[model samples]
Target: MVRGNIRGSAARGGIAACCGLAFLLFGYDQGVLGAVIGLDSFRKEFDDPNRNLEGIIAAIYDIGCFVGAIVAFLTADYFGRKGSITLGTWIMVVGTILQTASFEKIQMIISRIITGIGNGMNTAMLVIQSALIAFGHPLSTFMGLASRQAEPSSFGWRWPIAFQGVFIAAILMFLPFLPESPRWLVHKGRIEEATDVFARLAGKNSTINDPDVVRERDDIVASVEEEKKLGEATWSEVFTEGKNRNISRVLLGAGPYMMNQWSGINCLAYFLPITFERNIHLSVELSLILAGVLGIQYFALSWL
Candidate 1:
């Protein structure tokens, strides 16, 4: 059977576009709640949840994302990159529906977690998770503004949550025509299929035996064989120095992300509008506008 039709840079571009949409959905979900959380209608619907409850409602998605990451870790190889993303997209759709229809705080929280899980799975399988995040935030902010301008009812909040479906739909549409990760095929001992993927990714002029395809295919096979010889590293080995400074390497790799998270940027990202209103003493309207501007700033700077 045939795989993806596109080849070379075109195929890579298609795959990158799919990954970009996935992260865009992630950023939209991250910022959409903040856009509407401070609204009178939102507060009224949830009975004016206290700061504690509000925090839970806002932060619970991360917990779901963590679980989703673990889920991806356990299942991504078996499902393959494309499969993991497709599954995650469907899960996000389900979660988005639950969130949009939510009238109760509990349902909203649960839905947020579900959405996070899907995002987590996608992030685990793809790169550049944050590259397009700024775009998503501003898009959500615009949606929130438009929905509120149209009607200051529940639709204001619900529409922002549901707008995520558009991005999810793009992913579904593009995924089928995209090739799975060639390295993953090699890992599964599907050499011929992996070669085909390499050929498609290399260019239309390339075949399975094309020199470029052969070199890459052989490189992946060698790398996979070396990994097989080392065997899978256990959780404990991650902390131990059984072979090489695994612990140090892990810390070096993870430290930047940990510090970024710890720097409270997310707190700002997730609650920017609210912070502007409550802390900076700005009006809600001004706060939302400023948040949107900040989101634009983030999006622009991301290119650098």
Candidate 2:
């Protein structure tokens, strides 16, 4: 039993590590644009002769972010975390390639929007996955440690984003071995499959059949049977029922969290170089380096 627990812990730790890599990718996607915009090549390619065009070009990525957020909210629950994340990664890969190769201002704008979609999807998916995996686990400890490593300059902005592709590739390589969420399995009425998954996660030896596993399997069956006695609520029913008011309350309360995106810290972070140049009289190159360092510090502190 001790050996089984140890193996189970290790398996959970492996999943946590993979989840942390996903978070790193999330941070990189969010941080890279600021660094790129500060580069001379970006300015020379997009700034043209008009200041208004420059501002418009710069805001296009944020517009993409809005689009991505809406799409993620609408689809992540329906498609599952892994599916959304995989799709988001492909979008990111395409966006990055487009941005890297873009010579025209319009192309850059389009690429930024594409990248924003990926970024938003990644953010939502990562958060949901974290919460789900951490539900019965020691989430704070795992996430706190992972969060410490979220520094922006840990690999510098551009390299971090580029490195995300490698991490995503690594995830794909190992995904076949990963078990789907048991909750999802159970919800789909795959009781036996879900039981097998739970047993595997609990590290049951192939030769040893445990009564505890049977008990757990029976409990799941009983719970599902009980749930069926009370009809499942539709989306509208969930909102209309007083007993389910907590769900609506929580959703309504999340407005403040959404508002944080527009609270100016991110805006400042994204346009740090431009802000420094226009307000503090720093050159673009120096401003980006400073911004990168500061962003790293900000991310590092979040872990603490």
Candidate 3:
């Protein structure tokens, strides 16, 4: 291809699109609850849930996510990126089903843990999680509100929760075709497979032996070799080092997410409509509508 020629394929763009959608799903699931939790039917179904109950329902997912991350870290080498995500996706589907079908708060809490474990596997940069919350929260709120319009029904909140199914379905469809992360391929010593995947990502007419492809693949292998030389790592390294204390880097890496959770931003993301209604004294309908507007803003801001 020419230096500036149009060069992208379904494989190339599809992977990006799938990643975007996956993150979107993550945000949607996280945010959807604020709206659902605020509904009259939901409150009744769960025995008039209070702020404390809301907090529990909202926070339990994080617990599950933490556990999931540990599992992912331990088993990542064996599962590969694609396999890990696929497994997480399946777990999420089960969690979604439970969350959607749940009538009691206990059931919902359990579901949250299961779903969170799945999400934990996929979590990365705090910004990405924030972006997901921003986009999905309001949409979910409105969906719950819409379902409630069919008054005298006890199942309204379930519809909004059920919407997670749609996102999961999309992921299942695209995930299999999405190329594996190059590092995982290289880690497993599948150099040729990694090369082909890299070539495909690069574009048409690119071959496994293409200089750019080969160089990039070698860089990954070299990086892995350097890591091997460093030998097995221990959690202790995160706190100690010879002269270069890794604790500082660890704290720096963790600070954003810690701030996000402790600063009340995440709580707000999952309970915005509730906050608007209960604290700001807005009517339920108006609160959700405004929350939807906030979601739109969050989605727009994510591109930056």
Candidate 1: regions farther than 4 A off:
1-4
Per-residue lDDT of 1-304 in model 3, one digit per residue for the tens? 1122222486766666656667777777877888777777777888888778888888898899888888888877899877777788899999999998887778999999999998787653112334655667677877867887854465678888888888888877877677777888888888887887888788888888899999999999999889889999888877885578788888898999788778888866888887898899998889888988887887788768
> Highest TM-score among the candidates is held by which one?
1
Each candidate's lDDT (Cα)?
A: 0.88, 0.57, 0.79
Residues 1-304 of candidate 2: C-alpha lDDT, one tens digit per residue: 0122333555566556556656555555444555555444445555532556655555776677677778877886566555666677678778877765666878867887897787667666554243322121112122222332434332222342354467567655544455555555565687776676567667636211467666776777777777878876577664563776856786688868778756876666445655776689896556655665555555555554
TM-score of each: 0.96, 0.70, 0.92
- Candidate 1 local Cα displacement, residue 220, angstroms: 0.5
**lDDT comparing candidate 2 with the true structure:** 0.57
Q: Highest lDDT: which candidate?
A: 1
Query: Model 2 off-target regions past 4 Å?
Result: 1-7, 49-79, 128-163, 204-248
Where does the lowest 10-residue lDDT sum fall in candidate 2? 133-142
The TM-score of predicted model 2 comes to 0.70
Clashes of each: 0, 1, 1
List, residue by residue over 193-293, the lDDT tens digit for candidate 1: 99999999888899998898899999999999999999997899889976689999999999999999999998888898889999999988888888899
Error of 2 at 103 (Å): 2.1
